[model samples]
Target: MIEANTPLLRLLRTYWPLVMLSLGLLIIVAIVDSSGDVILAQTLIEGLVRIVIVAALYLFIGNSGIISFGHIGFVMIGAYATAWQTCCPYTREMFMPGLPVYLLNNSHHFVLAIFLGGLLAAVVALISGYAIMRLSGIAASIGTFALMMVFYSIYLRWSTWTSGASSVIGLPTTTTPWVGYAYAVVAIVGAFLYSRSKWGLALRSSRDDEVAAKAAGVNVFGQRLLAFVVSAFFCGMAGGLFGHFLGMLTVDSFGLGMTFITLSMLVLGGMQSLTGAVVGVVVLSFLIDILRRLENGMVSGLNLPTSSAEVFVGIVIILILMFRQSGITGNQEVYWPFKGDVSASSAMKRQS
Candidate 1:
């Protein structure tokens, strides 16, 4: 018989929630790959990419009870950063002549470039968040929105570097379903670890009541800034994956349209819970895929406009907000259902 007090059993009891989520994702990926359908597989990869983005958003917004409209700006920063290191050297020399000689002359591996993209975005977040995180409530949200707009305008006008409203092509198409899946898993684990960390708990305390958190000796601003930087890192990596997946980058692709859609997914999924983020992405992605097919006339005798999916998604969001404000997961994490002593399960968790 298995020993109940053994380390292995304790580990399992502590992390059963993560194990279950990971297995569920793996099963979905396996089924899709087994079908041998290229279009569906491609869509699956895209959905996984969104999971990374939405999960990163949840790391900050969910824990801090803050909304951000400019996180997509970090995504744009990361995409072009990857483009700089992974795009063709010849294209760089011709179109992005303003790039430093080192970058213009050499191209790096996509994996290295992707990581560098995230690092650069994190650096930007560190700088901007220092100021933005000082503001609370809606002011901070507006600050992020402004940051995104500033990024959009700069990228739009920076012709010699970002192609100036033109598409930056020749990025190696290296993002396969497996690659996307790996990154998505990494994102989930990273978010979970952070959520359980002391910093995460402190930030959430401040989120719920800033005054009380301050009375308890928490560095509210510091916690917010830390979460912001970490969240940006994952978002930037997602942007790199997005660029490679499509083999092209455009400023317009990272604008308001993307910002709103991602925010909508986060809110729909229950911005206060990580499980909600993943579930929201999966459900909405599936819905969009079906709606897209209908829009493309997949069904005989059916007519739908090109933007029907967006309209339908908006309607769904309205209904969700009106009926279930806490989101589908009710702001709750997936827990070990068999555990009779829930406190013991929590106590068994080792601090990261």
Candidate 2:
């Protein structure tokens, strides 16, 4: 029973963007391609994880009025947790010997490993939330960022445990495009439910005006903690899925680069609207694809070479931030044009 004029989402279903037809088109594409189609499938699957993580980020930041640069740490933690599960002690005996004795020894148990990774991430967030949410503004961001740096150092230096810089191998990828899209659906729905729920409203109240929301009986810290925990859980799940999809991972993959990229997506799409996050990830992903093609041409045939496609992405981010500070949605609903219906819905919602 959740409802909102989620603009990009509703617009995504329209005929013009062709988004309404993308899933079907991709399905056909997957079916038609037989040779090394797995690569294409893997890309799509990882994109799904990105969508979920971005959605969760929007949910938390939207409600809590907080910014985070450490969500990627959750991804790193998840990757290591899953990697340890599939560590293959005999092959890389110098590193992790095996998972704890209580867990499955097979190491290739994809479902179990992924579940463990997500759970581990949630647990970390739950613990960290208590400490981090106690602060406000830049303090919270800086603290969580320190947490990520500490985790990164541990993963990099603890070679005996995480195999240091050597890529964790022997992982079995169970992620697919279908699996990714399913997650995006679930995450989007979950974010919608959260935005419409009483708890979500309380958090949003705090986001809009902390003193006012506190007067209205919302424990601001508690609301922030709850959002952080929920956000971390989904982010962790996305990270686990990503780990298995690539079948290879390193601490560097979930670094500040990822943090900046996702934050850019959130900003470009609209921080207050989950629809914005969806749009951002899709647009950015496609942007990356186009830049890669362009870069390929430059390097292969044209003779001029570029350092990184991310430079192009960075430029897009700067432009979006400069031109649209409130982002595309600007705290407005997609169907705000439907004044009568939207007003009624708002009135009924307030009454509820």
Candidate 3:
């Protein structure tokens, strides 16, 4: 057992990974804010949001070893949920007549709306995951894809609730860089804590060997559902941030393109560790931004086609897959610079 008088250095060493990630984010924020480049700042803000989402995905996918194709569905639910409560009351009444009287007649605070949106998404995950988590392997992946399609089709046809393919505008532009950074830090901490929890360990055990984990008394499905719900909550929160940042929404934005890009980020970052999630988003976001500038001719002397960014990312993904299946992080996290008894430290942390 750890003593109450443990040195401050020891405590910091125990959580150095979290400290490192948080400080790294702060540095990024500082640099971006000082750049005075609105477009660059926006790109970083979006990248921070992606960190929230990809971190959420890491909680489940990394621990469970299951590739999910439907998390964007939860993101969709979150965006629409926030939009319903926070959009202009007049606009909601006019565009979404199917909403109840309270929804149509009143507006909610953006923070509350974002929280509600996450809660709603979590509830949906609880309901859907009850069924989806029962399946395993490729079947489970297919189930999630179907779920995404279901959300898309429902939102597309249900004009009353979602404006039927029309953009839902009037969201408060409140998701500044700091807000995004704060949430990203929260997500990283939450993910790290979860990874260190008994539930996360059990899920990973099942991921490695289901029969062995089951023999070891792990309730695999229950653990999976828990991860799913928690993951959805953060993804939903990301959706809320995204909507507020853009000050608008469209169902199409939450479809295959988003699903593919986010999954790619996760896979590219090595999907097996928390470090990979953040690293993946940072690396890919910067690459995309550079490619976008070239494509848009923001940088003189070079010009590319409109869709060149996507093509380049695709090529990068292919190269990474072929040569570095474990991604740039090699399925590992950033460890403390000074090596010590990591196993002992991990055990102590788990005990605490």
Candidate number with greatest lDDT: 3
Clashing pairs in 2: none
* Candidate 1 residue pairs in backbone clash: none
Per-residue CA lDDT of model 3 for 1-352, tens digit only, reads 3332358767776677799889998999999999999999999999998999999999999999889999999998998998888886667777788898888888889888988998999999999999999998889999999999998999999988889888888888889999999999999999999998999999999999988999999999999999999999999989999998999899999998888888889889998989899999999999999888899998888888898988888898899999998888888777666645455545668799
Query: Could you give the C-alpha RMSD of every candidate to the true structure, in order shown?
Result: 3.6, 5.7, 3.8
Compute the lDDT of residue 282 as modeled in candidate 2.
72
Q: Which lDDT tens digits does candidate 2 get at residues 180-212? A: 776677677777778778989999888778889
Candidates 1 and 2: which is better by TM-score? 1
Worst 10 residues of 2 by lDDT: 12-21
Taken over the whole model, the C-alpha lDDT of each candidate is 0.89, 0.72, 0.89
Error of 3 at 209 (Å): 0.5
Residue 102 Cα positional deviation in candidate 2, in Å, after optimal superposition: 3.5
Candidate 3, residue 238: the lDDT equals 92
Clashing pairs in 3: none
What is candidate 1's lDDT per residue for 66-110, written digit by digit as tens?
899989999999999999998876667776788998898888998
Q: After superposition, how far is residue 123 of candidate 1 from its true place, in Å?
A: 0.5
